[model samples]
Target: MADSLRRIDSGEASDDYLRGGGTGAVWRPPPAKRGALLQEALVRRPGSCIRRLAQGDRARQMQFSRFLHNGAVTVTEMAETAAARTAVVVAGRDVLAIQDSSELVFGGKEARARGFGPIGRGGNLGGLLLHSVLAVDAVTGALFGLVDVKVHNRRGGKVAARRARSTADKESQRWLDGMFSASRVLHEAARITVVADRESDIYEEFARRPANVHLLTRIAQDRRIEAAVDGSTMLFAFSDRLPEQARFVVTIPAAPGRRERAAELALRYSTVAVRKPKNGAAPDLPNSIVLTLVDVTETSVPEQGEPIHWRLITTHTVDSPAKARMMLDFYRRRWIIEDYFRTLKTAGFDIEAAEIQDPDAMVRLVAAVAVTGVTVLQLVRARDGTTDQLLRDAFDPADQPLLETISATLEGKTQRQKNPHPKGTLAYAAWVIARLGAWDGYYGKPGPKVMRIGLQEFHSIKYGFQLGLRDV
Candidate 1:
């Protein structure tokens, strides 16, 4: 590692990207050398292990592993830096702190690894649960970055036993941890709406949010209402009685055993006092709190299956139909993080499939690669008429020229097959790489998976390109 980085000082350095440049201004790792090595190792290869990134050099791979094990470089510091960078991205926009958790499955010689917890089907697998919060501009709907990520292991116990514990002590804490972290880091944003699914519907989470930070989560708790609008009715019953105010159409993505389809949904909303739950009570929560409840149900039943239904609770005022619709839109963006997890686990980074046995190293690798995962998503998402900003906004200065040189070479049969977005824009670069990764060189846009494979290939090209320059 020292030998490679030393080239930088002697004008022998090909470039920082080649030198491993994932370490950015947000992090402040001690003995800056570790920071440099990490950047080089991560950037040189999007998701490859130390051995692969180090060109199959076993000793070098051990050095890379040792660097992660060093006490000087802490995971909190790395995560904090990532949060700081995300804060900068969330500066002025009304953003959605989209949070969700996914379980990572790993295998080894033993089912129960020392550092890992029971995982997978029947708890026979070993792995970690990654709960992450990604920031998205609420108004413009642009991807910012990941503001918070909480990785933890589930302890061996009956599901009922785990649920009986305190919310703060259980896995549910990840929701609060994500919300508070976003509020603290992106505090300057116009408004931060913490968005998540039903799993995030915790009473403690609602009671704990800071001012200017609202939560938009699907309601799971059916707490009794103190003052029903018509009678002593529960949440769903009260919501059911409200007249449908608006009708809209929503597109549902394809899932296992389900085909992608569009459905016409009827929106029902009501202003109600959300009563406290009888079970797992929190001291700070009032007996009942005023909140806007919005329900979007597929009034039109689909041909084959259940229609889409989302019961949402929010602190944001949703008195008007437009506001209600906008809130639903915000909730919909929660899927962006879900797509992000796919990118991490599938083609791009494959952090879940990582074979590293050491828990700390695995954490370090995931944390470092997560930054790139965010960037890859940004590149792909920005193609949807979001920004005309140049590729320099996302790619390194050194990578631009190489990308440009290859862009024309990767073009399709006609001009339409080539990238039409502004030159140097992130979308243009994405187009070129997508072409390199076997996208139909024409106008059919590439998805996250295609973009990731392009990036992985681009890194190899860039790595060899930089090494070749060293000969000069």
Candidate 2:
């Protein structure tokens, strides 16, 4: 199948090769066969269409199906495929690969399966954890692709759980696994920075990550360490170097959900290089340089006079007090991933609702959803390039009647009057695609929703922009 698609893409085979014929086989070429084939191939079982395309004299399609059905394509093969796709998308870009985990709830009281771990209760359903690595363009926020995904399972024995570890103690190990897998796809880039929350502060994570991959994570309160200068081990403490003039004020915007407003106080500067005690059992652990910024805001002063503080730590060099302040600005971008997850779950890909029974199948399905979301995000970023107008021109083309229909439907007085959300080129494009996918029913009649739209539609709209590049 890949060879035939390659031949077609290379113009080596005539359209006849794709036409219907004899031999009890029917080949119906869709209007957008290239896009369709590529999209389907992205998610289809390995070698499913290889023989049907007749690119290989040996290895028939049936044989390939048998291979996949027999589980001949190992998990390593799937991981490789994901790595390749990620490399293709992120090549030559400055990106921050963000790693996090979420839960997918599965209902019913069936026996827990291996590789399935209980996360938390969700209404009447039970949740299973899914750990994912998402590579995002640092400046543009475009999703490059997924670095890797693992289903967190607790049913597996302790050894198996250790093998598929999810605890902070194991994050660095997982980071190593993802880095190697991504390196296979990305080869060596100039730099690859990894950003995560406080849970990522495992000693091994900082010790083992490739030097080229800079690590930035929040610091947990329970983390114990010592100042590296004197080799003195003690509990981590807040920097006492806060400016004497620093004043804490209750600001509503800075501290949301505070009943009587919240204080936003900034300390002047402080740096602490983390060092573990040599006498400890884990003496191999190396010291990690961390610049700390403690922001104490009074969300609600308890009757006991206790104050709340948000502590942030970073590996970034802070030459001056001003430089340290920028660390907060940099950390704000981490919230972008939260927005992304919300958009992904609410827009169409309700990953938590997936019903795939097997762990492998669930992994594949979640990856597929992430792929689709990334493809759309690419379009959004491309069209909304600095000159926001580019998106309006691209989606509201005057020459294309189909696009015109989409515009007209969106511009209808009823839609304008009834819909409160402001519509723009990006929104219009999303709405059009969603509507075409029968996202919310074009005219109130039931139609395909964003989730129901197959990969073909996503490919057609995306490739239609000439943004897609063929893998050589």
Candidate 3:
């Protein structure tokens, strides 16, 4: 492992994507020296603190700390690198860019010291607000990676009313910003579909959507429709009146207070012209925009559970039952972003536990974790072989040989102990890493924590392997 650091320090292993120059206030990628350090820090244990990432080397720990606190290492540069990597995988493929926001609460005193803003409903909490977009293969549901990320805290004290504020001055603007960000990053993709939850159902989100990019979001408000079509009926009531087209069963994942249960959902679809509100923020948008609504309602509800219902609004063509199902599947991909937040928070990185009090350093840490969190998700997504991702998705081309050797050494003579997935696939690499993390392959699937540990071990071994080659 020491040998790898030496190589990086000498600029022998600097990332090609990070080599560039910048002018003005824009944060360009660091020079080869810092670029090498940045790459090493990112590939370290995902979600680990600086001390752990430094592996008890006191000098390395200080260097890691300096890297985070450095003024040149900005979130903008980190996001650029993430986008460049995502563009490679999504090229020529239809992709879904899932956008969502999450709050990281660090307490009232911590907030005041760290310069964080209020985050809860009552405005009593102090934390940072993170909105990000994760790209996925539309057809296969394979994880592509993060396309864009925005991290900012609200103003210390807010005194503006909803009607008084423009979309640029409001937090809700992140939804529109995410769309623009994804479009810029995914220009290489054959098709781009942006998916979000109800909070993203803004007039501008639908109006300002980039050409060739589709939008899908759950209905948030009981918005009014154009009166010419059906006597000024509202969206919800109009949806309820639509005839059911099909019924399907789905297993709903368990949440904080909600138990997992099988839901029988009746699907309905219709085209409606959504009328712009009298006080709509964006006056430049058309008075009405035609959109397809796919309504899903639970036919049978469990005794202790609320009935599942989702009125999905989309720009996708949903004239047929098959197309409606496809939209639902795309909307379902929104959960991937939610899972990513969990991985960054309590599940994998435990980012909230970091003791960095400086606001800038904390922001940089979040940016680094934002990229690392996706790596953990990639491993979890690949563990089941459902995602047809290649080893290159999560690892470098040079690392493939090391993974192959590790897989062979970990396998036993018994077929049950062998890696079942095909070689050069992310699933096969995941199996090898799981075994390295002490997982019994037959027990169950390897989760984010297992993948995190396995990744740490792999990096350590990879460095030692590089050292041996240099010695030879």
RMSD of each: 5.1, 10.3, 5.3
lDDT, candidate 2, at 93: 68
Model 2, poorest ten-residue lDDT window?
18-27
Best candidate (score: TM-score):
3
How do all the candidates rank in terms of lDDT, highest first? 3, 1, 2
TM-score of each: 0.87, 0.60, 0.91
For residues 1-472, could you state the per-residue lDDT of candidate 3 as single tens digits?
A: 1223223222354344332111001112244454444445555565557777666778767776776776756677667767767877788999998999999887876576668777877767777888889998888778888888878877775567888888887889989988998898889999999999999999878988889689999999999896565568799989989999999898887777888788888999998999887794666888889999999989996756679789999998788888998999899888888888998888788888777777777887787678767877888888889888888787765677888999989999999999999998888988988888789888877877787778778888987887899999
> Which portions of model 3 show Cα errors greater than 4 Å?
1-32, 227-230, 256-259
lDDT of 1 by residue, 42-107 (tens): 544666466676668776676677666654454454556566656765667788989998878777
Model 1, C-alpha of 430: deviation from truth (Å): 1.2
* The best candidate in terms of lDDT: 3
Error of 3 at 126 (Å): 1.9
lDDT of each: 0.71, 0.45, 0.78
Query: What's the ranking of the predictions by TM-score, best on top?
Result: 3, 1, 2
lDDT of 2 by residue, 220-241 (tens): 7445545556554443443543
Summed backbone clashes in each candidate are 4, 6, 1
Residue 5 C-alpha lDDT in model 3: 24
